[model samples]
Target: MPRPAIHQSCTKIVATVGPACDTPEQLAELIKAGVDVFRINTAHGKIADHEKKLKAIRAASEQVGSPAGVLLDLAGPKIRLGELKSEPLQLDIGAELTFIREGEPANDFEVTATYPKLIDELQPGNTVMLADGMVALVVESVSTDRATCRVTASGEVRSRQGINLPGVKLSVSSMQRNDIANAMWAAENGIDFISLSFVRSDEDVYSLKNVLKAHDCDAFVIAKIEKPEALEHLEEIVDAADGIMVARGDLGVEIDVAETPMAQKRIIQVCKEKVKPVIVATQMLESMHHNSTPTRAEASDVANAILDGADACMLSGETAVGDHPIKAVEVMSRIMRVTERNLIHEINHSVSHCVHPITTAVTNAAISIAEAIDASMIIIATRSGGTAWVKSKSRSSIPTLGVSDCPATLRRIQLFWGIRPVGIEKMASPAEIRAKISQWGKENGQLKKGDRIVFVTGSGVVEKAHNAVVVHSVE
Candidate 1:
C-alpha cells in the first residue's frame, strides 16, 4: 500500500489570515502544518488586502494539493468606543465619564460611542464593559445622545475598543452596509463559508442568507453566537444557519464569565443535535501570539473543546498575528490527534441516532457496519458532500475517505470532522467508484492485502439519495 496523500485528523483547525501568514510561502506552510480552513476577517483589512490574501491562500492550497476552505468573517453591528482623547485614557476607580454618540469629539472625561442608539438602549444601572471586560462601568444617567457612567473598575481604555452592554438590546440592523458588501465579495470570490459576527437572533441568520441569495453566493453561513439575546432563541438560530461558532470573547463580557463554559457546551450540544458543525473559537491559543509555545492550560482548553464534541477549534490572533503561526497550527493538530485517540470510543458512542431521513439511516448504518467489522476505512463517494458529512457525524474510529469529483466540494468537506477528502475523476457507476476507491486506497497505503473496506454512496443521477452501502475487501 502507498502512503495517504494528506495527513488524516478528526478535529478541524481554522486559522485566521493576517500579516503573520500573508505571503504565499507562509500560507503554504500553515496549510502543510494542518490548517483546514483559512478565515479572512473583514473588520480589520480593506477589500484589496483581503483579495491579495485570498489569492495567496488559493495558490498555496493548490501547491499543497489539498482543497483548503476560506471563511469570510463579517463585522456585524458591533458597538465600540469611537476614539479617545489620547491613545489610552487612564481612569481611576469611581471616576465619572460620559459616552457621547459618534462624530462628537470627546473631552478628557468623555468617550465617543460608535452606535447612535447605544444611549437609548442603555439605562441607569446597566453595566458596561470595555476592553474584554478588563474595565467596567455602570450607567448612572442618560440623555438623548450621551450617557453618564461611573467607573466600577479602573483600567486604560483605547480607541475603537469593544463595548459590551450586558442585558441591553440595542435596536441596530444585524446586517450593516459593510457586512452586505463583504458577503457579496466573498460570494463572488468563491469563499467556502461566511461567519456572521454578533448574531442576536434567528432572524439575523435569515437576513444574511437573503443577502447572499441576492448576490448569487451560496457560501455556508456560520452564526457567531456572542450576544446575550442569542441564548433566548438559540435553537432557532442553530436551525437557521449552516453552523454555529461560539465567539467567546465578546460573549464572556456580555454575559457572566462563569456562564461561558456552560453556554459553550449548550451551543455545541445544540449543533450536534441539529447535525450542523459547531466551532469553539476565541483565545484557544492566545498565549501563542507572542510565544513559540502555548501554555499547558491552553492545550487543555483545546483538548476540552474536542472532548465537548466541537466540530472545530479556531485561532484568532494566534495564527493571524502570532509569531508562531505555523507552529500554532502544528501544535493544534498535535493536540487534536492525541485527544481523539483517547476519546474515539466515547465519541462513537455519543453520537445520537438519526431516525428520520433515509440518507441519515443509510449513513448511520455505514458507520455501524464498519465498526462491527473493524473495517480499515470507510469510503464515501459524494457529489455535494452531504453524504460524507452525515457519515462523519457518527465519529467512527475507522478513518473516512471522502471522494468527490468537484474540487469545491472536496475543499468544503475539509472542514467536516473526521473526513479526509480526496478529489477524483467523475465515476460512471457504483462499480467504477469501488474500483477507484480500491486503487486509491492501495496506492495511498490506506489499505493492504486482506483489509476490509466499507464503501458508501448515494443513488439517483443527481446524488440526492444515499441508497447503497457495500462491504469490500482489498485484493
Candidate 2:
C-alpha cells in the first residue's frame, strides 16, 4: 500500500493533462505539485493516448505511495463543422454562411452540422454564434438544406468553430455517440468521475445515470452547467449530479461575458448549498497558457471562486499546455489557501432545521452536550445537511464533518465553514462508529487512544439521530 496524500485543511486543486505534460516524469511533477486530482480530456486525445497517460498517472501514484483520483472528461455534445473544405476559409465580412447537412462536402467552406434540423429549425433573424462567441451571424433566410446567415457581427472564424444557435433551441441531448464511448471507457477504468458536458436538463442526468448503472460504475457524475437551457433548470441538475462544474469557457460563450461572473457565483452557491462539491473551471489561469504570472483580475477570479464556496478550482489550458504547469498549480494552491483563510461563509444554514418532535429533542440534547463538553470536534452521520446545520447554528468552535453514505453529501458540505465533508458508508453500529472515530482521531493527532470522547446520535424517528452516547478509546 502507498502512503496517503498530505492533509490540506480545505479546498483542492484539479489539474488537466495535455501536450505539455503527458509523460510519467511530467505527470509525477504535477502530482508532487499538490494536484488533488488529475483530469484526462477525452475531447482532444485518442482513447489510446488517454490509456497510455492513465497508466502512467496510476503507476506514478502507486510509486509515490498515495494514489490520487483520475477525472475522465467526456467530449460531450460538441457541435462542430465537420471536414472543412479548406483549412483556412476566407470568411469575409458581410458574406453569407450556411451550415450544411451531415453528409455534404464542399471545396471552400461547408460545415457538416450534426443537428440535421438546425437549418429547418432556425427561423429568419435568429442569432447564430461561432468561435466561442467571437463571431456572430444573423439568419436572413431559412431552408430545409441551408440557412442564409450573414456576418452582421464580425470576428474571425476558424476551421471547426463551435456554432451555437441561441434562438433556434433545437432539442439536443447531452449524451452524444462520442460521449457514450468515452463514458464507457472511463467507467471500466475505475475513474473517479465522469464530467458531463452540454447538460441542458435534469433528464439528461437521468439518462446518463442509466448508462452508468448499466456498467455498474461507481463513478460520480459532474454536470458542466454551460448551456443556457441548463441554467433554467439548474435545480434538477443539482439533484441528479453527484457534483457540478462551473465550466466558464463555454458558459461565457453561451451567456453574456459580463454575466459570467454573477452566473458563476449563482451556480457555485446553489451547488454548495445542496452539499455537493463544486468545481470552478475554465481560464482560471489562461495567462499561464503563455506567461508564468496571472493577471490581477485572474487572481481575483480564483479567489472569488474559493470565496463562492467552490470545493475545487480547476486548471485547463494553464496546466495542459501552459508555459509553467507546475508553477500554475503552486500559484493556484497559494491563492486558494490565502483566500480561504481570509473569507468565511456568511450564510447561516441553521434557520432551516425543522424536525419531528423526538428528533428535535435528540438534536437539542446533542448540541447541548457538544457545547458543554467543550469537545475538540463534532461529527454527524447525516444524509441531509440538517444535522450538520444544527451544530453550525450553535456556533460551536469545533471542526464538524457531515459524514454520509452518499458522495453527493461530501461534495455538498464543502461550502459550509469549519466543516470537513466525506462520503463514507454507515458505521453500522454505535460501537463501529466509535471504533472508526477512534482510529481517525489517533491517526490525525486529534485525540489519543486513552482520551475520553463523547458521541451523540439522534432518536430512532429523527432524520440522523441514534439516541445514544458512548465513550471509546482510540487504539
Candidate 3:
C-alpha cells in the first residue's frame, strides 16, 4: 500500500515502539502520520526483540520515504522494586513498610528492592518515592539489609515499580554493564542516535562517547537530563553531548514539580545557544493513552514546547501502549503547525549571532535573505549536514531542504527542526549540485516555476566545508 504524504511540520515528533506499534504495518502508519524518529527503549525489551523492531522500522521508513531516524535509549542505573506476593499492595497513610535488599516473598508491609546498595546510600529522614511519585515514604531507620520507611503519601504500590531518591546520590556508574552491551549493539546496527539515561555530569557523556568511538559508531549521543546533579553541570554536559532530552518524569520526581517548567525553558534556551538539538519528553499527551481525544491542557503543553523553541517533542506511553497512537501524533502535528504560525514574529526578532567563522555568517545571511524575500525554501547541499543544522538554529520561517549523499547525515538531520532531509547521488561540481537541487525541488513538489530558493553549498574542492551561498529561481 502506498503511504499518504505527511505535511511538513517544523517541530519533529518521536514515537516509542512497543506492543501497540511494533509491526511494520503499524510503524508505517506512524511514519505516514509524521513521526520523525522511532525510539527503542532498552529497559522494556531484550536486544533480540529490539533488533527485530529496528529492522521493521527501517523497512517501514524506506517504504514511506521519510528518512525517519532511530534512537536507542539505554537504561542507565535505575532502581526498581522486586517481585511482590500479590499484584499490588495498598498502604494507608502513616503505615510502615520495609524494603529489603534480597528478593523474597513479600507480605502486605514488606518488599524487596533490586539495588543492593539502597540501604547504604540512604539515611534516615530521606524521602523515597515509588510508582512515579504516586507513593511517598520517609525513612525512619536503616539496617544492614533493610530500610523501614513510613508512608507519607500512600497509594497502591506495584511490583517492579521505579524508585526515586530525591537528594541521595547513589554510588553507581552512569552506564551499567548491560547498558554498554546495548550501546555496542546499537552502534553496530547503524542506529542514528543513542540516548543516555540518568546523566549526571559531563564525565558520563564522555564515557558514552568513548564507548561509541571504541565501537566505531557515528551515532549522536543525547544526554537525558533527569537528575538534579545534571542541572548543576548543565553547560559542561551540553558541551559534551550532541543533544539533550528534557526527561520531565524523573526530573519532576527528583525536584519540585513546580520547578520543571522553568528548568525546561532554561535548558532549551541554552541548547539553542549551543546549536544542539533539544527534545521535550514525558507526559505531553498522557491522557490520550486511553482516551481518543486529548485534553485542551495537553494541546497547550505541546504547543508551549514548540513555542519555547524545542527541536522535538516525544511521545512515550502514548505511542508505546496507547489505544490511539496515530491520533496522538496527528494532534501533536496540528498543534505544532498552529504554534509555528505564531512564531514568525518572535523568530524574526531573535536573530542568531553565531558568527564564529565565515561559514556561519554565510549561513545566517542566507536565512536572512530567504526570510526577506519570502522564498519557498532554503536549499543546502552538505556532505555532513552542518549547514542545514546552522540554518535550523536560526528558526527562520522558511523550511530548510537539506540534500546529502551520506545516508547517515540524512538520517541525523531528520531530528533537526524545520529541516527536510533528501538523499541524492554525489555530484562532482557546483553546477551539478545546483541542477540536482532544482530537479529534486520540482520532483518533491517543494518548488514551482519562478519560485525563489536560497541555495547554500560548500566548496566543491573541499568536502564538508561551506563557503558559497546564492539565490536561484526554479526553472
TM-score of each: 0.94, 0.77, 0.95
After superposition, the stretches of candidate 2 with alpha carbons farther than 4 Å from their true spots are 1-9, 90-92, 102-109, 345-475
Error of 1 at 383 (Å): 1.3
lDDT of 1: 0.84
RMSD of 2: 5.5
Candidate of highest lDDT: 3
- Give a tens-digit lDDT track for model 3, residues 1-475: 1111325588899999999999888998998888989999999978999999999998888778777899999999989988877778897789998988776755768888878889898899999999999899999999998899999998998888999999998888999998999999998999999999999999999999999999999798999999999999998899889999999999999999999999999999888777789999999999999998899999999999998989999999999999999999988988898899887533222222322356566777888788888988777777776677777777787867777777888889889888888766665455676677677668877668898888888433246554887888889
- The TM-score between candidate 3 and the true structure equals 0.95
lDDT of each residue in 258-358, candidate 2, tens digit only: 99899988997787566566889998888998888999999998898877777788998898888899999888877876776665434333223233445
| Model 3 / residue 428 / CA error / Å | 5.2
On a 0 to 100 scale, what is the lDDT of residue 22 in model 3?
93
What RMSD does each model have against the real structure?
2.6, 5.5, 2.7
